[model samples]
Target chain A: MEFTLEDISDDEISRRRDLYEPLTASVRELVDAVIRTEVDDDSVREAHRLVQAAVETLRAEQIDGSYGVRFSADLQGMPWGNAVIGLRNAIAPPVQTVRDSDGRVTADFTLGAAYEGPSDCVHGGICAMVLDHVLGDAGSADDVPCYTGTISLRFLRPTPLGSLHAEAVIVERDGRKKIVQGSLSDAQGQTVTAEGVFIVPKNWDGPMPRKARRPGEA
Target chain B: MEFTLEDISDDEISRRRDLYEPLTASVRELVDAVIRTEVDDDSVREAHRLVQAAVETLRAEQIDGSYGVRFSADLQGMPWGNAVIGLRNAIAPPVQTVRDSDGRVTADFTLGAAYEGPSDCVHGGICAMVLDHVLGDAGSADDVPCYTGTISLRFLRPTPLGSLHAEAVIVERDGRKKIVQGSLSDAQGQTVTAEGVFIVPKNWDGPMPRKARRPGEA
Candidate 1:
């Protein structure tokens, strides 16, 4: 794992979040609209055209490849391109994990129509995705990057697609390996429970040397 | 599990696939663009407005709830709301599974920037998502709906983004439970391997009765 230090100020990071997070949220809403819209064919065609037009506008200027994990010098991360919690990823439910003083991580979020599998239920794979993110987050430290080695999940019951909660804690640590346990729940209770092994590479250093460029240098 | 018999014809289903699949593909491109765009703030703002406008047009017409699994009288499934393989879901990488005569399921697809978690690697959860879908599809008969009971995944190596492959097969069965094994691989070789137990409900009957309504009646 590597972290590219972009030398961005905290304020610039905040400003970028302010600019991008809402756009991500809006795009997520657009996803729901496309799935559930019962519009006339003409309206659907029009919406598709307009969406593509916006795509063209953005594609006019872009990076060459994937957005790697970038961070400020202080270790504030801009993993906004991440699939599960990326601030700029509309596909993400964007679990906003909060770390406890004791190192437990928790998040409260919701699944919607776009995440459906069975009738009214959150897809089983989605349950695993959220669990993997929260569990991986729980195993991470500011100075180290944690990668998931293995995970086992049990679907105790069908997780409904609505308000949900997730929590993860480091159950054990063995040298460079951490054992994490996590769960995803609805109001009724925990529907999916997970346990995973997270590993910190032996060759780990810290973040990369600060790049002399500012944000948006792509 | 239930299926709404929409009385949709094969010709109509093909036509709708023609209409919506391209739209889904475009929206997916839009997602990648949003992630990698290096446009100026003014351009970003303009893109946002245009995207929201498209959202508004689609929201002008709507459905009351999520799209449940729909099928035709001949049992052609239209699980267009699925997260992993939904035809109309922009978030879905949309695994196109082919069932072999021996009942194995396989898919070859690509994961782009939007699926990244670590640098240039496909997110662990996305791998699980695609695996679950393919494994479940393998476990399912045309007459039975397979639900994931448990899944265990081992990250053999970092799964790189871009072209990839997946395969699943039923290794064993215990009455209503099907034990399935699956794998996700990069060009180099297998990167993630999975084992899952899929359950067919004890009271399984079949698809829901034909609701006398036509397609797009949502």
Candidate 2:
């Protein structure tokens, strides 16, 4: 749980998002293509070469290690390297979430074929993954960064892979520990429910801003 | 819960693995590059264009929708579209697991920058994702395909990025339900422990082959 202070402006962050978000989207598209492509061997081979070339181009000038959690002086977070909701991580469904004035968090997103587990249903682990992020995000505040301490999930039914909805809210809080409750639903109704304990560590100066959790999006 | 009979031979499956495995690896590399690249804006733009070009080339010949679970007549499975262990899914840590004679399942893999959740540690949900796959894989036999019914994880500590090990075994089993326990550990020791209920549904003719689980790989 390390937070690096990045002395960059909001404008710079926005500029970087402009530069990288589309690229992330492009890579995500490539992932889907790679999975479902019925192309002949030569075409697949050529695509691989081009993908390798892209990797080389990006790797030509890069940081030594990871893009860890970075924040501006104002506490605006750039958790763009996150796996579940990272703005720059193509692997993410790029789960965009919103926080209500009442402290509830909600998101409406889609899971494609890439997220499948059984038949046309979403992977149970993926459901847990999204629920973990949503619940953990819901339990955190402006000056406190919450980390998952424990999480339990019950699959009431198989979550279908398509337009899905999720919501989370802090149901109980004991000092630094928050017990959050959440659910994942498809067009029919709720399929999976989750509860988690999110803890804000002691002596922690790291504050992961909730800028991504705008109100209107919900 | 649907499995399509691929009608492909073992040789063809091996050939397909040969074709897509490296491509998947390349895409994984691309994901890491996208995360840590500190290249200038123009270079990033160029990289984006090249990635889009590759996507277009692959899209030129593709399937209609998502790649559902496919298997050959002899029950060799190609769950290459899986998000946790899919050989073709770039989002996956591509966790490769093996089952021992005693029915224990284990894996050793490295998670890179692309799998980060907090700072340097693996995301909680990603941990759940991998464990769900591993535990479910452990409880399942060749004739019976188990699906996750419930999974609970206790984050004993933050799972650090890089080399890690995980193992799972069926602790108990009933007619259609299996109780499996698992853990994820880093160099320091155990960071996360998990327990799950995996259920084999009724009238399930779809047996997800355990071909991916060979004995020696454990």
Candidate 3:
């Protein structure tokens, strides 16, 4: 009883979000070929019987529940199935953000070997889930939707494994709380640094629908 | 170049971990039927052209490499491809732990809607990635592996979704650091509480291979 993105229709949510972003980028390239496949166990049992006959032809055409969150008046609050920025979530790296007219919320992404950890870095809980989701969207960059409550991280090094960057800023608020500040960089710079509070949910009375705010917010 | 579980062989890692846990639970039920299929936009463009012809028949039966970490001399330092408790990670919930000879470690799982957030709860960065993987496996429960350098969560409520529970212990230690206290419960109790520090890696000289400890430690 909870699905929203205002329950479908803005050209059928942009034609099913352009048909599930190339099928979640071909299941994120079959999750980086099942995390770096090296073949043979008879070619992984013939690619596991051809991915089990494409999972039984998509489970013989079915659907009863759960693909919840869908919102779109064209990508606002970006819920294409958000696990962390769902572009149809192939376990999201679906992070693509930009919010600036001085509000500042930036993010760029890349992390493979399915978000690794330690011997090739990048997984300190996926850099605290991308700095707790870009510091809860930079504490709602003032359009007010917030929610994290608390977050604190400080990895400082070891975030490697391909192009990454994140930024967030808000610094303080209170009375329904805010306090943001975030980071996560690679290619040598900051690795992880976050601080969050976020709140705004005494049953959300107003403020969130500047077309849902999150795609170059203002 | 860095794929451990001591380079495979406990009966071929228990027959490829019992053949990829029923093929990652049938691709996690075809990822909950590609997120609740309500078919028809011509059966979702014929189930997205039969999932792009099953992703071009497993990209034409090829294999280059990436299923990296795999360790099984009986799960020592358990890295079956961990995202957070990897059982071949269909986005991990391979969480099944027990460690308590007074070292304490505990965990139980459940949070599907593929780990949602803000609306059926569960997903404050997956309760800070299951309290940073159970407070970095309870600061190495004494066998010393530790890693996460900082963690701090609070949340205090809103975790609901289904059967959770987590725990961690080791309330203090220093010298190679430790701290660790964790939580995340359901059925209306403690919905997130953490404190961590962890460390132990200034080039990991010795300590971790006590069969990768942390499952009722000794």
Top lDDT hit: 2
Which candidate gets the maximum DockQ versus the true structure?
Answer: 2
User: What is the TM-score (0 to 1) of chain A in model 1?
Assistant: 0.90
When 1 and 3 are scored with lDDT, the better candidate is: 1
User: Residue-wise lDDT of candidate 2 within B11-61, one digit each (tens)?
Assistant: 998898999999989999999999999888888888898889889888998
lDDT of 3: 0.68
Which candidate, 1 or 3, would have the higher DockQ against the true structure? Answer: 1
lDDT of 2 by residue, A143-164 (tens): 3667788899999988888999
RMSD of 1: 4.3
Please, what is the whole-model Cα lDDT of each candidate in the order they appear? 0.81, 0.83, 0.68
Query: What ranking of all candidate models by TM-score puts the best one first?
Result: 2, 1, 3
The lowest-lDDT stretch of 10 consecutive residues in candidate 2 chain B is B209-218
Q: Interface RMSD of every candidate?
A: 0.9, 1.0, 10.0
DockQ of each: 0.74, 0.79, 0.14
Question: Measured by TM-score, how close is model 1 to the native structure?
Answer: 0.92
Q: What's the TM-score of each model vs. the native? A: 0.92, 0.93, 0.37
| Candidate 1 clashing pairs, residues 3+ apart or interchain | none
For candidate 1, give the lDDT of residue A113. Answer: 87
With a 3 Å backbone cut-off (N, CA, C), the pairs that clash in candidate 2 are: A118-B1, A119-B1
lDDT (10s digit) by residue, model 3, range A101-162: 87778888887766765556666887897788778877787787767778889887677777
lDDT of 1 by residue, A50-113 (tens): 8888899999999888887787777666788989888888888877787776878889998898
